[model samples]
Target: MNKLMLILLALSLLCPAIVLAKGDVNLTAPAKDQALTKLLMTRHSVRAYSDKALTLDQLSNILWAAQGINASGKKRTTASARATYPLQIYVMVKNVTGVDPGIYLYDPQNNKLTPVPKGEKRTSVVPDAVKQDWVAKTPAVIMISYSKPEKDLGDKTLMFVSVEAGAVMQNVYLMCEALGLGTCAVGGYDAKAAKEFFLLKPGEEPVLMLPIGIPAPAEPAK
Candidate 1:
């Protein structure tokens, strides 16, 4: 062997991870430090937002992170119980560029937003979200809904659906943080009112609402 090979072998004997090809790459630390921990440490619920508008790309990425098909075939960002994939996402487009103002169903498989045609009412989503002024101010609100059959999840359907919805929102929160945006989970809204505002079907259930927007400069990055 050459001089470099001999040196590498000697170093590997002293420190097993010292081999040049298998250098001391603290894999676990790198993962948490670079990815998970950074996001977790910085992630905060942002209810206040600026008047800035979000581009279509930003909205698309956020939606994809929430429920897009990222993996091979139908696998998504989050784990679905029994692959039921019960969640449906609806975007209330208020200030997104290039998209009209309306509630659009997110078609994950096709990666497109199909506009949910509904008559414009006198009142907006503000009242449905218990009159949270921020909801009206934000550029967009992502509503996570469920319309799967109960038989897929048995009698504990609500429980599973709730758990799954939590995952979806967590994905949204992280994605928003990464995109320099802000969002908050609003469970205080009237579910019945949300159903009417979003025009839900008989069996479709509204689970959670995420009011997303450009956060006003309040807290500095940690």
Candidate 2:
């Protein structure tokens, strides 16, 4: 096996907690200015989705776009205030190919998905959270959560976390647009219920939920 494959295999064997769903890390890098500008101009929220299933590579790219290591020093794709990356990413998988339906946490360090229990509980709360049918029907939902910062930071911490979540969500949107997929940022959820459902630690709060899928076909012109 190649060196990279060998390393990935080793990681999978060592980390039993993470379900190392194979994803293409070597995504085709896009040109900086023109491509990015195009993506930004065309990106839009998509609430309706087709039945097509998302591939593991697509999921990996989406997660990586949110907070993957960008620099040699392990800086993230999204910036953080005081480098306090309090945001955590969780995904609810419902119709992804090659992955079981469940809730999984993104391990940026390892680039793997770690399964968590009680993912189905999210279904019961989707309507209460957003009151939108699409939220429950999307193939997957990416949730950005915040772990309470040190008490010393005070209320500014919430501001920083919220900004960081915005950055992460924007990255996901741009990535989805580039990948020809669709996603919507949803904030109309019951935070308390989501926190409890996700079994978050004390002070951890679910900040935003992004429902993603293959967008439905455009309506025919009149």
Candidate 3:
């Protein structure tokens, strides 16, 4: 009907992968990601999670989807403004296969997690930060925070950083869906309080919180 829609129709006629989709156009996955079409449709927020611990592979993939460096070893899974990937990912590991209960920093460069010094004792603050008691029982909480100094990034630059962080969250959502795990992105937390909760440095600021684990089965009908 319009210029953009007409272009899409022409493309659909040319490419089998560009078939018409219900609801929205982006729901159509590319040729390689047929499963992704279904995954995108079914993805939903999962708040109530089972206490079962995740396998090492599953845990690794979740973190990788968040900020793992790609096979190229030069670019990350998510986009960064000017390649300045300033978001730091921390794992509040209450339960996981082989990994001990502690807070670990995701080293995207090496694809290994390093324990955050004195991080084990700081997790009691999570329940308060997320304002949910059930988070205390979730297997892991992925914490994304802005680590660059505010003065250097400034207000406008931080806008780009926030957009970058959002892309990271979307990747996590899709990854969790594909792995049969569940996750929910949480906002509305007090930045100062969340910063203290993560034990961040003076200039670091917390951005987003994600609680991920196996979804609890729905209650049976009475």
Candidate 4:
């Protein structure tokens, strides 16, 4: 194990509350081949969302698909460079069944959400970050942040971290498609404003955001 892994292990052991046990919600086993292929073919960036609320099961599945632990020994659905796993997932909930409106951090290990301060601020920050009306109106927004990597790792760390973020986002896109939900991966945002809005720690930076919800009806073809 290298320095980063050792640091992560130490942190996990020290901060048990941040790590969670297996998810209690029962999830239907995913059909690997057929469903995945179909979803890929149908998936599209959806900017408009309906007022439908999301269920706990759907939220659980989406979070799992994003970066949940898939294997033993804390392995995740997405790969991390040297298992550094520098990404943090936060959900801004506007309308989720059984979940109060707020911002919550995804605890992948426990498969739960830990509430964060300023949940109502989600709307105010949306315009500052991306200035997109649809994004602020979505039922939920998943924000992916890059926690600073070790300085000794040098500049290559940014590239690896970005690739990891993309992998997680793709997983989310495919999962949303399978769930009959709509989402758009948003990269056009003010990074500095996001950092302050989300109350990110020093060195942590917001990388991407996904606005997700039930899709609005498609317009009739002309």
Query: Largest lDDT belongs to which candidate?
Result: 1
lDDT of 3 by residue, 144-167 (tens): 988774346556787988898899
Q: Which order, best to worst by lDDT?
A: 1, 4, 2, 3
lDDT of 4 by residue, 1-222 (tens): 999999888988997644566764545555656867688777788887788888989988999999899977599999888888899998888888888887888999898998887655454446777788878667888889988765445778889999999999999999999888888898998989877766676778899998888888871222
Off by over 4 Å in 1: 1-32, 119-123, 219-222
Per-prediction TM-score, please? 0.81, 0.78, 0.79, 0.79
Highest TM-score among the candidates is held by which one?
1
Cα RMSD (angstroms) for every candidate in the order listed: 8.8, 18.3, 7.4, 18.2
lDDT of 3 at 201: 65
Considering lDDT, which of the candidate structures 1 and 4 is the better prediction for this target? 1
Residue 33 C-alpha lDDT in model 4: 67
Looking at model 3, residue 16 earns an lDDT score of 51
What TM-score would you give candidate 3 relative to the actual structure? 0.79
On lDDT, the stronger of 2 and 4 is 4
Task: Report the error of model 1 at residue 207, Å.
Answer: 0.4
Which regions of candidate 4 are displaced past 4 Å?
1-33, 120-124, 150-152, 219-222
State how far residue 37 of model 1 sits from its true place (Å).
1.7
Which scores greater on TM-score, model 1 or model 2?
1
Candidate 1 differs from the real structure by a C-alpha RMSD in angstroms, to one decimal, of: 8.8
